[model samples]
Target chain A: MEERKVILDIHNFSIAFEQYENGFKKTSLPTIRELDVTIHEGEMVAVVGSSGSGKSLLAHGILGIQPYNATLGGEIIYDGEILTEERKAALRGNEIVLVPQSVAFLDPLMKIGPQIRKGKKDKASKEKLDGIFKGFHLKEEVQDLYPFEMSGGMNRRVLVSTAMMGNPRLVIADEPTPGLHMDMVRRVMAHFREMADNGAGVLLITHDLEQALEVADRVVVFYAGTTVEDADVKDFEKEENLRHPYSKALWRALPQNGFQFIDGTQPYVKDLPEGCPFGPRCKECTAECKKRIAYREVRGGRVRCIHAV
Target chain B: MRHHLLFIGKNLIRMILLLFGVSVAAFILVSVSPIDPLQANVGQAALGSMSVEQIEKLQDYWGVGQPPLQRFLAWASDFFRGDMGISLLYRQPVLEVIKVKLANSLWLMCIAWVISGVVGFVLGIISGLKKDTWIDKLIKGYSLLIASTPAFWLALVLLMVFAVWLKVLPIGLSVPIGMEASGVTIGDKIQHAILPALTLSITGISNITLHTREKMIDIMESDYVLFARARGESTWSIVKNHGLRNVILPALTLQFGSISEIFGGSVLVEQIFSYPGLGQAAVTAGTGSDVPLLLGITVISAAIVFGGNLIANVLYGIVDPRIRRGGKRS
Candidate 1:
């Protein structure tokens, strides 16, 4: 296969929140630790993780939209350049767009048309919006309507349209299909797939592995706010192709893979074990796993487990 | 268009019912009060010197012999017909007294209202946007202090500072005491109004500033605002495009709601300032047993307050398209 350009490269990203605890003393909660994800030109990478595994925080971190109290660590490289805070601000909306998780992200008082257009009234923008609305099966009049007037499916489409409004180089869709039906979820996923096909790097942040496998080129599994595995979509077709024990567990838990689950829930961030967050739950966990495990390649896929061969 | 008209009609009917209720309550309260209108209006010496027949005539004129309900019905009917009766204290028509008094009060109240609304809203936005900072702390502290401070006490303080100590402005009244009504310049009226208007505005700011700050903080933290930032919207752009509309609607509700508070404050404020506004007339009528004048002022003030709320409701539709459509479009 030809080497496509790397559109976004994330390295050791961490997010910690400073909060007031016990009188006036402050403590930092490491919500996301040493996470990593990479996307290439015309590729969709799904970062799959359960809720509070900091999947949403990863999206916010890349966009520099993390809350004021949050402290971010690690570097995010976009288009061969370091994406600093200033660069993120400059590239956002025009080059880097975020398809937010909920309809609540839309301004309620604003009309749908102006909102989707990002308040653009130019003729070209208008024509482009019309085309987008039509492609989404939304009536032209839908633009004149408020978000509260639209169906959940239509609003989701409208949100996708916002990312399309700009020719984004990177589209980070943070759990974009929640509260949507299976059909709607597929439809929304298809929209992200189309964006990737159009040559924009699309980061599909979701928990549903089955849905992620439908459109994503690679799956980056997040465990307790850190990436444990990054493997090709084809690698997920068979459990033996997966390197990490967690990936095998995830594959086994799929409905088609016998509907099995491992013991112990994902640990809370405060109580997370020293090295591998998945150590306590992994059947193959050894004393070596107790030490810091490096994310390295094994059999053409990246794995954070020392025992993975 | 039809929906808007129906809304207006509904609010108009509501306002009328509210005014009627207010009028009846004021009439009943005044009737039950321990103050004997005969004693209050006529001096003890005059009452003792008056013949038995004269005392009965005075009682008849005051409508003291009639049932409270009967008097209210008579007053309500005459009120609807535009005959507000005569003011026993002013010795003039009740409408005429209210008209002049309302005009003066409107000027003072309107000035105070605008100042409070504009300044308070801006301060609130600044405080909320800069939450936890010294500026936010300062505004919060100021609003808290103002909120707890009595309107009458504030009015007295202002009166002493501007009128007593400085003596640059008039201490009391809407116009100069020696000046004829026709001769009183707009400048003179404004000069005299400064102290009272300041007192009312200062007192009014705390409520709007505090409420709007709460609302602005909520907007700043809202998911939409966060998303807007993610979309690369500048902080100012986010405020203009998202925060303003959300905050302004609730702020407007508080602004209009403060009309009653302003009017209530005006009563004590006018008393301290000795301003010849509706509040001062209200007190005069209340003390002097001028039933017709009191009822008229009560009804008019109630209508003004109701009218303010009606305007606010109508404005909500203009401000928010969802309300304009009567509900959510879907």
Candidate 2:
């Protein structure tokens, strides 16, 4: 296979929040300890994780839009250069776009059209928005209505249209299909696939493995704020093909896979065990797993477990 | 547009009912008071020399001998016919006395309101944008001091410094004594109004500044604002377009609600400065038990309050599309 040009590369990224405890004593709570993700041009990578696995924080960190208290570590390289804060600010909403998770991101007092267009009132921008809105099955008059006047599903579609408005080289969509119906979900996934086909790297952050598998070329499994596996979408076809123990457990828990659940819940950030984050939950855990484990390549896929063959 | 018209009509009916209620309440309170209008019209020395028959005739003339309910009905009927009756203290038509004073009071109130609104809102935006900084802390401290200070005391302090100590401005009254009323220039009026206007504006400024800063900070933290920032919109544009638009509604509501405080402050400020405004006349009427003048002032104050709220509601409909459409839908 030919080497695809890398569009986004995030290596060993970590996020910690500084909070004041007991009036004046400051403490740092690490949320994402070590996360690594890479996307190539013309590729759609789906990041699959359960809630509080730091999926959305990864997206915000890449965009340099994290909350003020968060302290980010490690490097994020975009294109061929290191992505600095200034570069992120300059490229945001132009070369890079984010489809936020909540519909409340829409301004309640502003009309739908102006918000999606980012206040562009030109004829070409208007017509382009109309075309995107039409593809999403939104009416022409819907653009004139405020967000409070629209349904949750309609607002989600409007948010999707905002991403399509700009010619973004990278699109980060965070749980974009939650309130949408099955058909709308499919349509949105297809739209992201189309963007990927057009040379844009699409990062679809979601909790639905079935939905991610339907459209993504690659799947990155996240467990307790760290990447446990990075494999081709076809690896999810069977438990034997997957590389990590946590990934296999996730596949088994799917409805179509006999709905088998693993024992114990994902560890909270405060009480996280040392070494491998998934050590407490892994059935194959050993004394070696109590030490820091590194991500290693196995059969062209990456896994963070010492026992993975 | 029809919906807007209906809304206005509904508010107008409410205003009329409110005025009627205020009139009845004021009349009953004044009638039940131990202070007798007959004694007010005639001095205690004069009352001591008068015979019982003479006193009864004077009471009958002033309608104080009649029952409270009868007097209220009679006043309401005359009030509806545009007659405010006679002022026992000033011995002039109550309407005539109020008309001149109302104009002066409105001028002072408007000047104070505009100055406070502009200054408070601008300071609020600055403090909100620079939150947790020393500048923000300084403004907060100043607002706290002003809020806690008494309006009358502040007025007295200003009068002593600017009028007596500095000797750069006049001490009291709207117009200088011995000058033709028509000869009073705008500059002269402003000069005389400085201390009173400042006194009236301090409390309003404190309240509005605090309210506006809180609302602005809240809006800056809203999800929509963060979304706007993600769109690479300039900070100034976002603050002007999204931040100001959302904060103004609450700020305007606060401003309208402060109209009562403004009037209350005006009464004290006007009394200290003897500015010849309605507040001073109100004080005189209350002290002398001038029933007709007091009732007239109460009705007018009620009308002003009701009108201010109505204007605020209509403006809210114009500024917020949600209310505009929701009003129609309901």
Candidate 3:
């Protein structure tokens, strides 16, 4: 909230992509709609959303590597400076890094050693390479092994080591534990926590609510390309103060045996019901939800649905 | 070493069968020619002018009196024994005549292949990574135009523009062979090999280029590339470390069929340039109906195609681990 306090601030960020039709943009939705968020220095933010909710798309824009079709609006500020094209050039890989979903960060043909070497840092910085690999529970011999040799978890951890090797300020990890076993997920979450504790801002993007709750300090919920809620992880359990019905329903659907599952569906994008995108999915839905559109900040969080008191 | 040898041997057997099939097709087609080589040679050299004993002798010598299967078997048996008989035009052993020409052809083809394949693959990768970009669209259009069009015509156009119009190079017989054409130096031969080789390579290069680009696009857009990019890898590094490896494997498969690829399309390029290669020899023998010569060229070309496929199979194990020993064990 204060000047020079936030490390990364995305204000009114939206993305529309051009398609084959020439005159119109395509995809199920615009991806991100009026999404405002911030990351303080040395803070960890977790992005949790349904598939196609544009969490990845938002990351692409923030990283300034959105697919060629992406047309982004609004300003992204990093450490009190607005991120221009030139600023993004400096920010990439050096200031911020992303550990994508498992095994995606590797080159299939190349050995693991060179992959880490391909980072943005200088030669002397490369001496720390072996040390970093050791830290990730990998053998020093793995440096020469091709991606095909290592297990899936090994590949994901290798990318994480490469990410932190440069001493980057921010790390965005998308789907860190999608298909991993419970033990492996805990291991990766521990790695994220370790990085966050070491004073690097880590944004964990995933669909797993439990995984986010395990390691994330703060959580941002996305529904239908819009930010539905932003709240502290400590307060994620409070049901009444939760603003968006979509957000509340998501919390309900967590597979707790005693937890009551909310009966609501995520709104379909193209043929969406009018007004609040979550209206059709909300158990407390009414006709008035169609007419009102605004993000209301209540006690525990900020939510997009106007029905919240 | 044993593993490699065994793999090669299996592929070689498949190659032999393919070659045998192609040879049969060539033999049948040559046999069906409307103009008889004997007739074309001597206006129905019936040996009718000879006495009864002599006519029988001539028919026997030519193997015409034998049944078709017996004749074919005899021909095959003789071929295995390295006796290709004599060429009507050259008056030399067909094998001897072809050896020199095949060498020249192989040399030219090797050079052309090296240039075209490397260039095409590189361009394909670049074009593929940046698909729909100006460079990608340009390379795609250029490759499509080059590949769909004929190589011979393109050679002639290049020859006209680069040699005749510009006076940059010579017209024909640019290199001396067997001390025949003023004994030109190796440099001169290379200079001469340049134009003809270019003609032979353009379409192959273009075809390969286009195919590689298409493959690269698939590889680049894969979930893998996104993962690599997200790791803060530079665009160039991404292209090299990840994109190139994945994209180029399928293109490697393309080169496995390089045998049929070169000979099938190179016939016209050979004819246009008057390059004394297997293709040209085949054309001459086919036109003249010189059965033995035709058979030799047909078998050789078929063998080349066969070898190419064989090479492709072995290459599979090298490029993709899924096809290799470790993969099989799993």
Which candidate's DockQ is highest? 1
True contacts kept of 2: 0.51
What residue pairs are clashing in model 1? A149-B330
DockQ of 1: 0.74
**What lDDT tens digits, residue by residue, belong to model 1 across residues B42-138?**
9799999999999999998877778988888888899899899998888899999999999989999999999999999999999999999999999
Docking class of 3: acceptable
User: TM-scores of the first chain across all predictions?
Assistant: 0.97, 0.95, 0.89
Span of ten consecutive residues with least summed lDDT in model 3 chain A = A20-29
Off by over 4 Å in 3: A1-4, A20-29, A119-123, A257-264, A286-288, B44-62, B155-194, B312-330
Residue-level lDDT of model 3, residues A215-250, one tens digit each, is: 887888887777778888876676665667766776
Candidate 1 residues lying further than 4 Å off, grouped into runs, are: A127-139, B1-9, B48-56, B63-70, B326-330
Worst 10 residues of 1 chain A by lDDT: A112-121
lDDT measured at residue B149 in model 2 versus the true structure, 0 to 100: 95
- How does candidate 2 score on lDDT? 0.87
- lDDT leaderboard ranking: 1, 2, 3
TM-score of chain A of 3: 0.89
What would the DockQ be for model 2?
A: 0.63
- How far in Å is the alpha carbon of A178 misplaced in model 2? 1.4
Worst 10 residues of 1 chain B by lDDT: B321-330
**lDDT tens digits, residues A1-309, model 1?**
789999999998899999888859888899999788889999999999999899999988888888888999988999999999999888888799999988899999998898777676899999999998898888998898888888787888889888877779899999998877899898888888998999999999999999999889999999997899999999998999999999999999999999999999999988999899999998888888888889999888898998889
